[model samples]
Target chain A: MIHKRITKRKIIDKLVFFLSSLSVIIAMIPLAGVLIFVASKGLSAINLEFLISLPKPPDEIGGGIGNAIQGTLILIGLASMIGIPIGVLAGIYLAEYGDNRFGSLVRFMADVLSGVPSIIMGLFVYVAVVLTTRSFSALSGGIALGIIMIPIITRTTEESVKLVPNSIREASMALGIRRWKTILFIVLSTAKSGIITGIMLSIARIAGETAPLLFTAFGSDVWATGLNKPISALPLIIYRYAISPYANWQAQAWGAAFILVSFVLLLNIGVRYISRERYKK
Target chain B: MPHSFFLFRKIKLKKIKRILSGDFIFKNITLIFALFVLSLAILVFYELYSRSQLSINKFGLGFLFGREWDPVQGIFGALPFIYGTVTSSIIALMIAVPISLGIAIYLSELAPGYLRSPLSFMVELLAAVPSVVYGLWGLFVMVPWIRDYLQPFLESILGFLPFFQGPKFGIGMLAGGIILAIMIIPTISAVSREVMLAVPNAQREAAFAIGATRWEMIRVSVFKYAKTGIIGAILLGLGRALGETMAVIMVIGNRPNISLSLFEPAYTMSGVIASEYVEATQELYLSALIEIGLLLFIITLLMNIFARLLVWRMMKIFRGAKE
Candidate 1:
């Protein structure tokens, strides 16, 4: 009787355990579904014309989103230019001279900034930048995106910097080297891989952000070359197209989604590779 | 005489070099930049406050709790959006926390080694997927599916419950919560898994030696040991859900109403601001949205601090126990 009861209990335990694991495995469907669906459909829309052509009117069957692609590149490029230097400097402070309370406070604020909703950041930039500029501009949008990027870059830089051993710093300092030179040459160089990973990852994240751009860069159905004019981006275009009443627009929206997802995915994969390489070293 | 003059000049140059070293400049510059980072909060607060003076004077404290937001008449209140924000996020947390904890437990103790990394990677990938994609998927796929299938099934079983009763709308608090839950699950589970994995092997061995089964051992010792970190993980997830914007905005139906029915459409603070900030013609309307942003900022800030404290405390305990 005892042996039979033990066997039954074991069976129950095994069943529960397996079911729990299966639930997690099942969760992968949504992720896989998105990648597969977007890739197949998005690939169809990625011909030469699609890459170079402007968005067509609602009645048109298959025009491209060239303007949006260019605008997105501009915004992301400007965002990196503005965010990278400041973020790296701030990160240097946290890692090197971060024994002080102010350093801790900055670190904490950066963490909080990371958690703040992207839309809230957009509203902030809208009020601070777009309203002041008197019109939506690519510059304002870039700044807004930069604000979103800053916290991520700062945090990642700090983590990467911390991973570098302090013995290098001490050795340089003992050689009568300046604290700054030691950090820049010895510490930063050592942590360069991780730092690069952080930058790439932050870029990937900001590229897909739609909310902030909505309020700052905004929508322009036409091509944009001026900083003061409203700009088009993939995320914004997707948002607009997805919500349109037209079926063609919906397909375009799917294509836009595919482009945005792939862009982010490739960037993420690159970042992971860099981080892994750093780990291997 | 020439030699004496050269020695004096060399001493002067060395003095200058010592005073103006690259180390001194680099450290000071870094320190200044760090100081600037904290000062951004003040800058944002002051700038927004100055710009919002007109609205603040117009709406005063009544703006926050007022139910109506008629732009033409210049009436503005944020009660409904705030209500929706808290309710939907709380529901998301309630649903996500248990499932995430279960997944964490399973990944930590039950899963085969081969399945572990891939499963973990997939969950993390879900997190890395952008909010906008989530918004699109939530609208096109999840929302319709829920409306067509899940709603009928849920209402059939729980129809008597006030929260479950209503029309099966394609977008509403329930849909938002589900999407939010899905978005945050990976965050919670990944962090929770890290915490659970960090639990000492000795503790598990002790539990096992006491004749505890594998499941019991995990429940009693591993989970107990990592409870604070687990709490931190949940809080972190809650923070994400509370501040989620694009996905919620896409599917939340943007109705500014305080209702008990989960099937009814509602508006989150982030969603309201995202949808209306561009078209907000009135000063009060604009400032009211800014205030909502401020509120969100403050809430997220507090949650992050709490989460950091929890994780720090857990680390200390684990370290202390080990030492």
Candidate 2:
């Protein structure tokens, strides 16, 4: 009877193991399906004309997203300008002198800010920037994206800066370096790779954000006139085209998605590579 | 020689003064930036509250319970949205929780060491796929498949149930729920896997020492130990499902209606805001959309804080145990 019980337990264990493995397989189907479908459909839609020319009217075929591409670049540049300095400095404060209640409050708030939905960020910017400025501009969209990047960059920066060995700071201080100097010259350099990785990841994240850009950027079909004008972005274009009734627009949507996904994925992989290299040292 | 020594001392003193000023300036500047980060959440809340004032005054507390949402008539209510958000999120959790748990278990317990890192990376990649991309896929691919096959199959098998009784429009609560499930699986499994890994090896060893099978050991030790954290992970996933906008908007048919059947069209808080905010021409209409956003913001904020606390507490317990 004991022998039979042992066999029964063994069979149960095997069954549970099989079920768990099967769950992983089931979970993977969507990921694989999405990647494959985007690539296959998107590759055919992309070409020289698709890259260089402007989008055709909705009823027409053979238009490109060149203006959208330029808009995306402009918006990302503006966002980086706004997000990087503020995020890095805040992160520095948290890492170097943030052992008190106020510091913890800031950290917690950053977490809360990160958890706020991207769409809400759009709304907040709309109220603050768009309503006041009285137009949907690339500036407003960049601000929205910039705010979303702040918390992610802050958290990652703090974590990576914390990972820098205290001994390095001590060594700098021993040389009569100012505390700020030690942090700026020694600690930050030591954590440079991780901090860069964080920034890249945040960029990847905001690059594909669609909701926040909906009202803020407002999206234009023509070439962007100025930072003060409505600008097209890859995500906004994809969302617009995907929902429209035209088959050609839907096809263009896939192409934009392919480019966006490729850029984000490559950045993520680059982050992984950089972090691995850091660990190797 | 004395004059040269005095000059050198004077230069050293000036350099010290500069360093002190630099440190002071740097510290305060960074502090200002840090304060900006701290005040962001409060600012968002303030902005949302102040902007939604029109609706707040107009609807009062009854807004959440009122079901009508006609913009032309200026009769706004949030009940259908709240209903859709809750029901769709509940459906997502129901389907996602088990599969996520299984994946977490496999990753933490059963997977060979060589296979673990790559598998984990692949799961993370699932999350890295953009929301819009997912929406595009759901629109073109998943929705059609659902309309033709999955909904029909479910209706055939479970047609007696209220949820399965309606016509299969494919773009409804069920489709939204399934899409949400796929999106949140990565989050739940990743967190649960971390929590399970934090369960001390001693618990497992003790279970094995009693001649318990591997599955039994996992059930008695790992699951029992990491239960709170797993719940927290599930809540985190729920929080994500609640606020998901684009994909659900694409597939949920964007109709503001309340129904028991999952096959009928529905609208979520985020979905309504995304679909209608730009088009809202009237002051009250705009304010109503902002109010929905406010509700979504508060719910997600509370959910995230609570879930983070649970996960943090659980990790702390494990860390203390290790010490």
Model 1 C-alpha lDDT per residue in residues B108-200, reported as the tens digit of each score:
888889878767777878888888888888888889988999889989999999999987986899999988988899989988998888788
**Residue B82, model 2, lDDT:** 98
Instruction: List residue ranges in candidate 2 displaced over 4 A.
Output: B1-20
lDDT, candidate 2, A209-263, per-residue tens? 8999997998998999899999999999999999999999999999999999999
Q: What's the distance in Å from true for residue B28, model 1?
A: 1.1
Residue-level error in angstroms, candidate 2, position B164: 0.4
Best by TM-score: 2
Return the lDDT, model 1, position A179: 77
Classify candidate 1 by CAPRI docking class: medium
- Residue pairs in steric clash, candidate 1? A180-B23
| Share of reference contacts kept by candidate 2 | 0.78
- Regions of candidate 1 where Cα sits further than 4 Å from its true position: A1-16, A170-176, B1-19
> For candidate 1, what is the lDDT?
0.84
